[model samples]
Target chain A: MNYPNGQKKIISKQATSWQSKKSFSNRGMSLEDDINTTNQFYLDIDRAVIHKKPTPVQIVNVHYPRRSAAVITEAYFKQASTTDYNGLYRGKYVDFEAKETKNKTIFPLANIHEHQINHMKSIVEHEGICFLLIRFAAHEETYYMQAEKLFPYWYDKLHGGRKSIPYEKIKLDGFHIPLQYQARVDYLSVIDKLYF
Target chain B: MNYPNGQKKIISKQATSWQSKKSFSNRGMSLEDDINTTNQFYLDIDRAVIHKKPTPVQIVNVHYPRRSAAVITEAYFKQASTTDYNGLYRGKYVDFEAKETKNKTIFPLANIHEHQINHMKSIVEHEGICFLLIRFAAHEETYYMQAEKLFPYWYDKLHGGRKSIPYEKIKLDGFHIPLQYQARVDYLSVIDKLYF
Candidate 1:
């Protein structure tokens, strides 16, 4: 009973049962799906309480015809001011943004917004665990780079440095997230080693 | 200048500056507005980073006309599975649901959803600070009640007990959130006292 729409199915109870599978070894799902599955797994075992924020939408007009639910007739997509996923881990505040890039050589800085960068900086200043989850879809590899580490490259772009992070550089700096049967992207194990 | 529409003014950046008025003593605003203003004040002083989750919407049809932004032609409101607000404070994970009631005698349990109650329970089990911010709109008083304290009443309702919490009980058990000039609701002060 897999739905074609990822967002719809993820919100449904069926998705929770779907994740009960022993493995997703070669399913080739999107990075969002994998992370959502991992989050659901974390929630089920009382390990963490993280969630992906809903897509921001700007509503202009809504029509109330009859007694049914009011329908949004005119609306536009709005940019999110913060990251996609946030939650609690080990009684510590964790905040992160996840992005998937098709490029094989580099991950572009344009994938993240300026406001979001500022938001992450503020979180780190407040002693929160902030990071960026970068997924190279071409290579099927993901890395978790701390916001502190990424700040250097982000500031370099303003000073006429490269606009993207090279794959080799990420391999050197960022921690690789291993995929597993229960915890799809076991990034927390890395956090436990680094931050804790 | 107060706008006629609530949504328009809320999503605007100018609203943050509007809170420069030393106090919200006379200006009657909803609990949500007060909390947002308080959060902005916290952020300005590097105190905390808390935000209310946006209202969820389910998009049915979207149209891309010309080079402008993508317009959602049809959409419907969706019920949120978790609480309204969540974030980090003092390197600790904090999660809470805020609700306002006009009732003067008791706070009805029906104001909260079963899933939200369960969600908060799970958050507490994970060793996260979880609570409810209940505002008595008539009296203009707010109280912060720990989720652990509320669990007994929540379970009692299932056993044919009282469906509402008496005002006297809340006054005895819950901590009063003093209204302040800079921080409107000043719930964080209560959090500081209890959790810290």
Candidate 2:
């Protein structure tokens, strides 16, 4: 999925420079930034209606002042009970969780919570198209692994087997998602190839 | 769809009394409480996978203590871009917004925002089962109206027609969601009647 050498170099160099310099104040954002940009492009063109669900927060306290908005004063992040992104595509239900890991060898199992795994299982049971978008940041590669494929690993972990999935195993089993200019992660292309 | 006379009377009396007594601290909840309870029952029995999206929030500032969970110090409620709830059911994507109105004669269009109407239009265009759940609190009734049926009114409002939909019109055009002891707002029966 490479473009011309000069073009790829220029684009990535600018992204790396900006992300490294401008985002220390907002650390750990650029990983999902590509997907967000991609989803927005999809929405703008009316290709799909996917959206990243809002981060779940537990509001414990609020302050209301006259002639102003109510401000949340105390809150905490709650564990999400479902996948991060889901929407309709081609008249089918599409659901997925996107995650990025820096580890070069294996994707640690702990990156996904138990409840999210259960939710994915329920989606599959109901015949919805469910999958995971995993990015290896160091390798600059994304893979689309269907939820059905992830269950064996989840069961292994439950039965006290390997705690992480090897990079090689994912490379063999998962489809490599080509990064497109407009749809950055471009997982929908993989979904098209697999299903349609 | 009335249950045994005594059963319905007891449940209504208990709910009205409890809601009046205990829910002033959490205003505007019981209307959705029925739906939420219904959804939970659906989940427990593996009937459908539906969820009310967590309220969208924009977090501006947070304070992280060395030994405690991060506390959000400043945040604001953000206008939701899509409907309030969505999930897969019987291999179909179901998306809907739930609104409760105290008005007995009319369901105000002002309860829904312009952007949300645009989003619902997109959902219907993509062939998802998109609808609205309107609860007339004063009348103790909930009605399900399809998104396609709503476009005319939405456009009429845009062109300086009636600003609100009358209760009588909703009663005629929409399907009255029967209240079951288990599936309190039983809209799925209407869905089966309409689509399947």
Candidate 3:
């Protein structure tokens, strides 16, 4: 993922500036869109079968029109009980949640839900590969933090400790997912290095 | 998972008959409900991490109130590109589409979609465990048909062959999933015999 020294600095500066201009949180239309494009590329090349689960909705009412599709007249979003993305990768169960933070210092622990942590715990216990993809928008970096690493932090938060993982801590412990041409969020490469 | 062994008619037969009368045209509300409950049982006991993906919906309009959660005003169901349920089981990626057929002699191919077949093809190619959970409500029998077994029928249909799988053929080729108190479908035992 090496770029010309000048080009790398220029790109970093532009992304750093995006922290303020992009008021929209990554809950998640930006990083998610890139990951989806990356997943499609992986699928086209016969690499993996990862997909973001559809947004869960509670349908309250439906209007069935004659000679037309049933329209949902009233519905509400349901909080997910599991991670946002999961699938098979290289004959292994891959599960992960992805989030982007504009914060330059730390990633707030509140970005993740308690149930999601429990879900990750179960995946890890079952010997499946589980992790988090944390994107620091200020630095334009995405880190792959293993479920094992995340548990301690979540436990610490529950124990009324620091409510965030410092950027430096993540930079030291997490693998930097390289930005690529087709696989924009090239995570499998990191999985290969760590697991394979 | 063995029951009293005398016809094994413990599960509410009256409800099954009622469900067939109001069958959702093979969209599988009856079987889907049972499978969802079964999956929860699996998760509770730490046997598997299977989940039914949320029904895909196209949100057309949403109203954001100042002091409450956003409500979807208009939406429509979208066709799923993949199967309904998938997750990790026995360290293997498990994927399947569950459907119930009231037909006594044949399971219709129309119950599945073209994209789902392609998605199954991909899963099989990647060495993931993929299959179909076909339940015959009339006979109260459920069969676990492997993805490999399903491909030939799909191709045959494309080549102007039979548009449905015969009940007898399924009985011969597919494994019978045992009815259980917890794992209602109990397909993993069949998986143990085949893939494990």
Instruction: Please list the C-alpha lDDT of all candidates, in the order they appear.
Output: 0.80, 0.80, 0.81
What is the C-alpha lDDT profile of model 1 across A8-127, one tens digit per residue?
412333323322232222466767788899999988887888898877777667776675666677766677878988988887889999887889999999999888998899889888
What are the RMSD figures for all models against the true structure? 6.6, 10.1, 10.5
Candidate 3 lDDT, A1-196, residue by residue in tens: 1211112222233323322234444333367777888899989999999998988876666776776666676666777889989988888999999988889999999999898999999899888999999988878788999989989988999998999999999999899986667888999898898889
Clashing pairs in 3: none
Candidate 2 positional error at B110, Å: 0.3
Q: Under CAPRI classification, how is model 3 graded?
A: acceptable
- Judging by lDDT against the true structure, name the best candidate: 3
After TM-score superposition, the amount by which residue B101's alpha carbon in candidate 3 deviates from its true location, in angstroms, is 1.1
Q: What is the clash count of model 2? A: 0
Give me the candidate number with maximum DockQ.
1
Question: Which segments of model 2 are wrong by more than 4 Å?
Answer: A1-29, B1-29
Q: Ten-residue segment with the worst summed lDDT in candidate 2 chain A?
A: A1-10
Native interface contact recovery, model 2: 0.53
**Candidate 3 Cα deviation (angstroms), residue A89:** 1.3
